[model samples]
Structure formats: C-alpha cells, structure tokens
Target: MPAQQKKIIFCIAGVLSFACALGTAAAIGTQLWVKGTILCKTGALLVNATGQELEKFIGKIQYGLLYGERVRQCGLGGRPFQFSFFPDLLKIIPASIHVSVILFCTVLIIFALVGAGFFMFNAFGSPYETLHGPVGLYLWNFIACSCGCLIMILFSSEVKIHHLSEKIANFKEGSFIFKTHSEQFANSFWIILVCSLVQFLNTLLIRFAGFEFPFSKSKDSGTVTGAADLMY
Candidate 1:
C-alpha cells in the first residue's frame, strides 16, 4: 500500500472511535436525567403519603440534596460522613464492572492493533506498512468504551425506589441517616449528562486521537463489524 493509504486507514479508525464515544455519552446523559426525575417524584409522593405538614418540605429536600447533607451535619464527634448512591464501595460495583469490561477490551484492542500494525509494517514495508493492523484495534476500543457508558446508564435507571423512600422517612423523623436519592430532574439530569459527556470524551481521546468524523471503511476488506460485537 502507499504511504498515504496507511495514514488514511488510521484516520478511519479514529472516526469509528469517535462515533462509539458519542453513543456512550448519550446513554449516560439519559440515565442522569431519569435519575433526577425519579428522585423528585418519589419525594413528592412520600411527602403527600402521610398528610403531614412535612409533606410541603419534600420540594425543599429535593432542591438542596438537603436530606443527605443534614445527616452529614449531624454533630457529635465531628465525624465526617458522606452519602453515596450505593453502600460504601459497593455502590460503584455496577459502574466499576462496566469500566472493567471497557478496560479489558481496550487492552485486547491495543494488542490487536500492535500485532496488525506490526504485521502490515513488516509485510508491506512501506506506506502500506502503516495500514497494518492498529486501526481496527482503535475502532474496537472506542466501541468498548461506549459499551461501558451504556451499562452504567442502564444500571442507574434500575435504581431502587423503595430504598430512597426509606431514606426520606428517616429524614422526616429528624434522624440523622445519610440518604442517597434520585430525584429532582434538574440536578439529576445534568449530573448524568455530565458523566456521559466525560465518558464520551475520554473514549474519543483514546480511540480517535483527535480527528474528524465519517470514517471510510478500510481497504483490507472481508470482515463484518456489528454493534453487538463491539459492546458485549
């Protein structure tokens, strides 16, 4: 292959990577938005559940993340406490799992790219050498990152409503129980969107190494790629 062709192939890989990144971001953003709505709605339902004066305060709690903060403000030994979506480090498990899968995929991609690149370089020993193998690898890595983003988003949506309700009850009782909730669409939406964007950007950087979009297929030919293979 010509020297120009090798560069072109790499560029194509970059574009594919970028596309994957975008998909990942979209998923995360949606998850965050859903979470916000869920929490706010839940709080409202509880506030009206008992017909107590505290019902009016549901909005207040939703607005400021006040319920959880109040628990942290609990004065005693001045112990610093924090609220998290999941218990201790366990909360991160789902996201962590997703991340882990992405990382593993990234490693495999790197290996494949290097092997392919090296093979092409040695085989053609010219501009064609550049076309080699790394392009496909980069393409796959982008896909993996995107997949991770999706997993995290789906997990977020599955958040247990009952758990949040109990937390609200604690706050209403004036007990300093640290609560983590999903409600208040504004905040939740933005957070999830931001998370998604970050993941997307990260994936883009890793996959594309910064390039324009609409990648053209490789000249190598013969091989089908699908979303299912990229993600799972």
Candidate 2:
C-alpha cells in the first residue's frame, strides 16, 4: 500500500480504538449495568395487605461494578451502597470470575490507549523499533481485543447463566430482606459488548495497514548472484 493510504488506515484505527476505550471506561463507572425491579416478598404475603398494598412493595434496583442503588417501597425509599467482590456478594456469585471481569476491563482500557498511541505515532512520527513500529501495533491491539472479549464473556456468564441479579435481589441480613421481581442487563452492559466488537474490528484495521500477521512466514524468492560469482 502507498504511504498515504497506510497513514489513513492507522488514523482510522487509532480513532476507533480510542473510542472503544472511552466507551468501556464509561460503562465500567456507570450505575446502569443492571436495571430491574425488586419485590418485597415478605410484604407481598402480608395477611391484612390488599392488592394496592402489595403494589407498594415493589422497588427499583440499579447497579454497576463499584456501587448500586436500591429503592425499597416498604419504608427505606432509595439507598446507595458501595461494595467489593471479596466480602460482599462473593458467596452468591463467583468472586474470582467477577473480579476477573473487572481486571480484564481495566486491561482492555490500558491496552486500547497504548494501541491508539502507537497507531497515531506510526501515522505521523517515524517509528523503527519494536515498541514504536508495526509490531507494537499488532501486540497492543491483540491484547486489547483479548481483554475486551474476556470482559464480555465473563460478565455475560455472571448475569445470564449465574443469575447475578436474582442473587443480589434475594440477598438478606438479619431482619432485612431484598427480593427481585425482574432483572436485566442494561445499556452499560450492551455498550461493553459493542466496545469489545470495536476492539476486534481494530485488529482487522491493523492488518489492512500492510503489516503482516505475527508468526507467519513470508515467501522468499531465490537470491541473486553477482557477475563475479557467476564468472567464478
């Protein structure tokens, strides 16, 4: 490819990777990861409560990796809580897996930024060695792609297969109770998936920039002989 075309491809890839990184970071920090309703199961079965009374027992739950909001209709109104994977809900959910999801998300963002930097550097600045060259582009992008995919897969498993929302809704301590009526992965979760796809697409952009895939051997033609060697 021409030098101009290569520069254009790198610029496009850099922009895409940067956007993906920003979206993933926003998704991680927002409380819109999961949205659902929690029903006060205890209140629902109150002996003297009527249908209208039961209607007052439902509340909303919205949570993210670091914090969450819970609204209780029984009397508590809305409350926010911050929690970690180790000691809070680890018993109900796989702490190791959940923590891994967050870890990989962090890795994805870091690698994405690094990849974007390399892409821009190669596009405008002269690059010759491993870190500043095409090899670095492939390395960073590949790592970012892997991290993004892992984040989506691990988080999806926690939400869909493991019933994370239900577990949180039903969690209780002493006389306090939390019950879930319905749960779902929200916009932030979907946005992470989109970011993962975008990272994957960046790998294709890297390939299109005339850099050969790592570990593949290129075909070599026969070596040319000098006139003196031929005469000898």
Candidate 3:
C-alpha cells in the first residue's frame, strides 16, 4: 500500500478503538447487560395461579456489573427496588466472580485507550524502533480482545450458573421465592462482543497496512528491508 493509504487505515483503526473504549465505558455505567423475568414460585403456588393469572406473579429484572433495578410481582402490583454490587450484594452472590468481571472490564477499557493512542501515533508520527511501533499495536489490541472475551464468558457463567437474576429478585424477600422465567443478554453485553470484533478487525487492518505479524517473519528476515516499512 502507498504511504497515504497506510495512514488512512491506521486512522480508521484508531477511531474504532476509541469508539470501543467509549462504548464499554457507557455500558459499564448502565443496567442493560442482562434482562430477564423472574417468576414468584411461592406466590403462584399459594394463589393457585395458572396461565394468564400467573402474570401477577412474574416480575422483571435487569442488571450490569455494579448496579441494577428489579421489580417484584408476587401476586401484587410490581414493587421496584434498586441494588448495587459493592457492599449490598456481597453476601448472597459470588463476590469473587463478580469482582473479576469488573476488573476485566476495566482492563478492556484501558487497553482499548492505549491501542487507540498507539494507532494514531503510528499513523501521524515517526515510528520508533521499540514496542511503541507496530508490535505495540498488535499487543494492545490482542489484550483488549482477550479481555472482551473473558468478560462475556465470566458474566455468562455468573448469570446462568449462579442464578443471578433469581437471587436479585429474592434478595430481601422472606415470603416469595423467585425463579428465572426468561433471560437474555441485553444491548450492553452485545456491545462488548462488538468491541471484541472491532479489535480483531484492527489487527487485520494493521496487516493490510503492510506490517508483518511480529514473529511470523523468519528470524533471518526480522531486520526487514521492504518498501512497506521505509515510509514509517
């Protein structure tokens, strides 16, 4: 590719990395990661509710890593409640797993910002003979992508295996036992997946910009003398 074309590629990748960072930050603040309905098993059994009557015993729940909103419908009108993970949910939920998810999210955002900075630097400035060059681009994007993957896996396990929604629904309730009726990952969870895909795409763009993968080139040719690298 021409020097001008390479700059354009790097610019595009930089913008994408920055956008992913912003999206992840926004996602962490919102309560749209997991959305589901919880059924009040005890209430339904007591009222002998069947079919359409069961609607009164079903409630809605949604949450992010830190905080969320839950509405209880135990044969009565929905009662809304808000919760936070730090100190409020430490006793009932799996504290270590939840904390790990938050830690990975923070890592993903930081690495994404670093990747964006490096991409812009490689495009507009003189290239250094160190990790700040092409190698750093690959390193940062890979780390961000890995963090994204881990966030999805860990959170999925916490929600499905640990019965997160049901636990939140029955948190302070002494009369009703709630069970997960329906659940799905909401927009914010999918946003992290998209960010992971974007990071992978950035790697391909770096390759398309004429930079070889760090170790794929033969050791004898590691000190390469190609037209691709001269402009940088």
Candidate 4:
C-alpha cells in the first residue's frame, strides 16, 4: 500500500485503541470508589465499638448488618433461638454491577495498550508486507475473563459474609457486623481518580503519537522463489 494509505490506517487505529484504554481505566476507578464507600462505613463502626453491655451489643449488631446477617447463637444456648439474615438481592446486585464495570474498563485499557504497541512497531517496521493492526485484542479478552472469575469469587465472598453476619446477628440480634476492607475504605477513591487521570494521559499519547504502519518493509520477492527466502 502507498505511504499515505498506511498512515491513514495507522491514524484511525491509534485513535480507536487509545479510546479503549481510557475507557478501561475509568471503569476500574469507578469500581474502587463504590467498594471504598462501603468499606469506610464498616471500618468506622468497627473502630468505635466502645461501651458497656449495651455498647457491645450495638457494635455487634452494626457489624452483622453490614454483611446482611443477624445474630443467631451466642453464649451457648440462651434458650437456642434461630434468626435469619439475608441481604436484599437488590443491593447486592448493584454491588456486583460496580465490580463488572471495573473489569470492563480493564479490558478496554489492555486492548488499547496492546494495539498501540503493535501499531507503533508496524508503522516503523517494514514495507510491502501486511500486518494485522493489533493483536492486543487478546489481552483485553484475557483480562475480561479474569474479571469474570473475580466476580464469581466475590459472589462467594458475599455469601459467606451473609451467613457469618446472620450467625452473629442471631447471637444477640443486631449486635455484630463485618468491618469494611481496609484498601476499599482508605485507597479506593484515590485509586479510581488516578485511574481516570491515567486514562486521560493514554488518550493524549494516542493522539500525539499519530498512527503509522509499524511493519512496513520492502518486498524482496525477486531474490528467490526458494523456500528458504519465503520463510525468511
């Protein structure tokens, strides 16, 4: 292909890939934010549990609620009553959605990065040979799969939390809840914000880099129709 045509293709690919990367970064950041909020509230409650019997009971209840469970058994039999703690699926679903978003964003970012790398090489590489724009597409796909796996793990984690909470809440009825994860409470918002910034930077990089065929190489067909030459 002509130099002009190659350059045009490069430009288009670069723009699209960069956009994908930025989008992914933003997604991860958002996930961190949502998780962080929940963590903060949980952690604060855990830290400030100081009081007499009543205060202790309140603390337990608070923790229990966070994981969507109520206390069922405490002090060994106290008449052995049963209690149930179930999270409103409505709330859990939203949490899961937030997680999904993060994964989606990561996938996009990987795609962009991979594409950029491939294209960058292509534009500078050789001439007369065709190079698939970006194999980075696979990178995103892999990341997405990993995200899905994480989501499944998270689902189990949430279930465990619910069961544990229920057991605790029943022990004394609204007396224990789980503390939020530390990273979520302390670093999520900042992490996500930074991610967004990274995305913006990626965008700028793609725009400025301007796409070009990285692998444009001159044809040496005339040298020989030999198998060795073809392989090379």
For each candidate in turn, the TM-score is 0.33, 0.79, 0.94, 0.31
- lDDT score of residue 10 within candidate 3: 93
The best candidate in terms of TM-score: 3
Per-residue accuracy of model 3 over 1-232 as CA lDDT, tens digit each: 8989988999999999999999999999999999999999998999899999999988999999889998888877999999998799999998999999889999999999999999999889887655578888999999999999999999999998998888888898887789999999999999999999999999999999998887786777646666544433
- Residues 1-232, candidate 4: write the lDDT tens digits: 5656656555565565565556445434332222211111232354553333222322222221112222221222222223222343333333554355445445546655766555545556542322242223233323433443453344335534544233333233243343422212223334333444443443344344443222333565356655433231
> For candidate 2, what is the TM-score?
0.79
Off by more than 4 A, model 4: 27-91, 94-98, 127-232
- Kindly list the per-residue Cα lDDT of model 1 for residues 94-196, writing each as its tens digit: 4454345344334433433443343344334432222233344444444444544554444344334334323432433342333443344444434334433
Per-candidate Cα lDDT values, in order, are 0.37, 0.76, 0.91, 0.38
Global lDDT of model 1 = 0.37
Model 3 residue pairs with clashes:
none
Which candidate should be chosen as best, given lDDT against the real structure?
Answer: 3
List clash counts for every candidate, in order: 7, 0, 0, 36
Model 2 misplaced regions, further than 4 Å: 47-54, 74-93, 173-178, 216-232
TM-score of 1: 0.33
